[model samples]
Target: MRADRLVSLVLLLRQHGRLSATALSRELEVSTRTVLRDIEALSAAGVPVYAERGRHGGFALLPGFQSELTGLNHDEALALLVAGSRRGAQAFGLGSALASAMRKVVDALPESHRATAAGAVQRLLIDPETDLLARRTDTEEVPDTVVTEVRRAVFAGHKLRIHYAAADQAPKWRTVDPIGLVTVRGQGYLLATRSGSDRTYRLSRILAAKQLAEPAQRPDRVDLDRAWQERSTRFRTGGDQVTVLARVNPSRRGDLVGTALAVRAEEEADADGWLRMELTFQDSRHAEWALWQLATNAEVVAPQWLRTSLRDRAAALATCYGVSS
Candidate 1:
C-alpha cells in the first residue's frame, strides 16, 4: 500500500506540475505530515523531487521528468483502452479526464505492446448510437457545470442547493445532503436526502445547482452499493406497484424479465414450453409498456384490467394497419 501511495504521489506531481501538501493529503486521503514524509522519501530515493517555500509554493519534480511506471500487460492495456472508449464517463462529466488518462496509459506502454494495443482498441466498438433496428439510444444532456458542482459537493461532504424540475412538476429549489452520484443506462442521478428522507433526483432534471458552505448532514462514510440497494428496494415496493401473472414464450423469457421490476414467481415450463411467471411492475402503465414490447411472445394470464388494456392496444395497432376482424 505504501509503495502504491508513493507511485501515485509521483504521478500526481507529474500530472499537475505542483500541488500543496494539503491538496496532496486531500487527493491521497492522507494527512499533511504524511505527505511531507512521502516527499522526503521520494527525494531520498533520488526521484529529483524538490519543495518550493511560499504561500503558493508546493512540491514539484525537476523540469521534464517523467516516470517510467507503465506496468500494464497487453490484456490490461486493452481493457483500459476499451473502458476509455465507453460513453459512460461523459455522463459523469469526466470525458476529458478519461481521455487524458488513456493517453498517459498508452504512452507508458512499451513500444512493442503500444501499437498492437492501439490497433486492437480500434476494432472494438462500444455503445453504438443506433441499434439493429436503426433506433437511436437517446443520451440525456447533463450540463458540465451542474455535474461539476454536484460532484464537488458530494466529494467534499458539503450541502447542495438544486433547482430541480421533476416530470410534470414545477421547478423548485431544494437543499439536499448528497450521499453519492450514480449513473445507469447513460443517465445520472444524485442520491441524496432532503429533510433526512431518501431522495433521488435525475441529473438531467436539475436545472441549477450550488454547493453550500455548510458541511453536509450525512454519515462519515457511505457504502454506496448497499445504500443504492436499499433505495431501490424502497422505490420498487412503494409507488403505484402492481403484479401480473403471465405465460411467456421460452425464447422471449429474458426479454420480459429484463423489462419487469421483478419476477415474483416462476413455474416450470408447460408442455408447449411456455414459461409461467409472476412479475411486478411500478404501475399499470409500466406493465402495459413492457408487455407491448414483447408482441405475441408474452401473454398476460391474470389481472383482467391489464389483459383488457393489452387487447385494446392490439386492436388500435391493428386498426392502424387496416386489419378488420
Candidate 2:
C-alpha cells in the first residue's frame, strides 16, 4: 500500500509541479506529515524533487521529468473521468480504490488530454444530492464491513448469513444464497434466495453479515437487471395496497402524487383551490406516512380509517402542545 501511494505521489508531482504539501495530502487523502515523509522518501530514492520556501511555492520535480506510463487518448480518459465522478463505486465498497484508479487515469493522460477530460467531467454532473425542486434525496448508509462481506460472498458464490432488521420486525439471522447486488437511486439491495424462493434484502437493513464457506445454490449466470425488474413488478402488483380519495392543496398535489403507486383518477381544481384525486399506495402505513407529511395541505376524503388515524394523530399533537382538544 505504501508502494502504491509512493508511485501515486511521483505521478502526481510529475503531472502538477509545485503542489503544496497540504494540497498533496488532500489529493492523497493523507495527513500533511505523511506527505512530508513521502517527500523525504522520494528524495532518498534518487527522485530529483525539491521544495521551494515561499507562500506560493511547494514541491516540484526536476525539469523534463515525466512518467513512462502510457497515456490515454482524450475520449478514453474523459469517459473514465466521467464514470469516476459518479458515486457508483461507493455502493460496491470500492470508493478508495476508485479514487486511486481515477488518479492513475489522470496521471496517464497527456496534459492537454487531462485538461479536456477534467473540463468534460466537470460539465457533466451525475447523482446530485438534491433535485431541481430543492428536495433532498435520502442516502442509505451501509457499513463498510458489511458491504465487504456481502461483496465477498457474492463474488465467491458462497452462502451468506445476515442479521437483517426488516420494517416493524425484530432482527433475525437468515442464510441466503446471494445472486448479486444492485444499487438504485442511492439505495443498495442484495438479490438472493432462501429455500429456492427469491428474496431481496435492503443492504441498509443488514445489521451484520458473515460469509459462509458453503457454496451458494444459484444459477451459473444471471441477468441481474431482469431479475431486479421482475422483483419490482412483483412488489408493485403484490401487496396490501390501499386506494384513497383525497382533496389536496394545489401546491401539494405533486408531493402527494410522488408517494402514490398510481393515480387512478384526478379532478380539476375546485373553487377552493383544492384538487380531488384517487391514489393508490403500497399499504395503509405508507398512505399514512405520505398524508402525514403533507399535514393539513392534503385531506383524506375516503378510506375512513386513514381519516380517523390522521385526526387522532392531530389531536395527540394538539394535546402535547397545550392546544384545545
Write the residue-wise lDDT of candidate 2 on 1-325 in tens digits: 6776777788778767789999999988899999999999989988889999888999999998766544433323433543543555566666655566677778777778998997897897677889999988776889989988998899899999999999999999999999998877778899999999999999999999999999999999999999999999899778899999999999988899898888999999989989999999999999999999999799999999999999999999888999555
Over 1-325, each residue of candidate 1 has an lDDT whose tens digit, in order, gives 5765677788777766799999999877689999999999999999999988899999999997877764544323433543643566777776544544565676677658977997898897888978999998777889989988998899889999999999999999999999998777778889999999999999999999999999999999899888889988998899898899999999999988898999999999989899999999999999999998999999999899999999998998888899655
Query: For every model shown, what is its TM-score relative to the native structure?
Result: 0.70, 0.79
What is the number of residue pairs that collide in model 1? Answer: 0
lDDT of 2 at 188: 85
lDDT of 2 at 227: 99
Candidate 1 residue 322 C-alpha distance from true site, Å: 0.9
Q: Backbone clash tally for model 2?
A: 0
State which candidate has the highest lDDT: 2
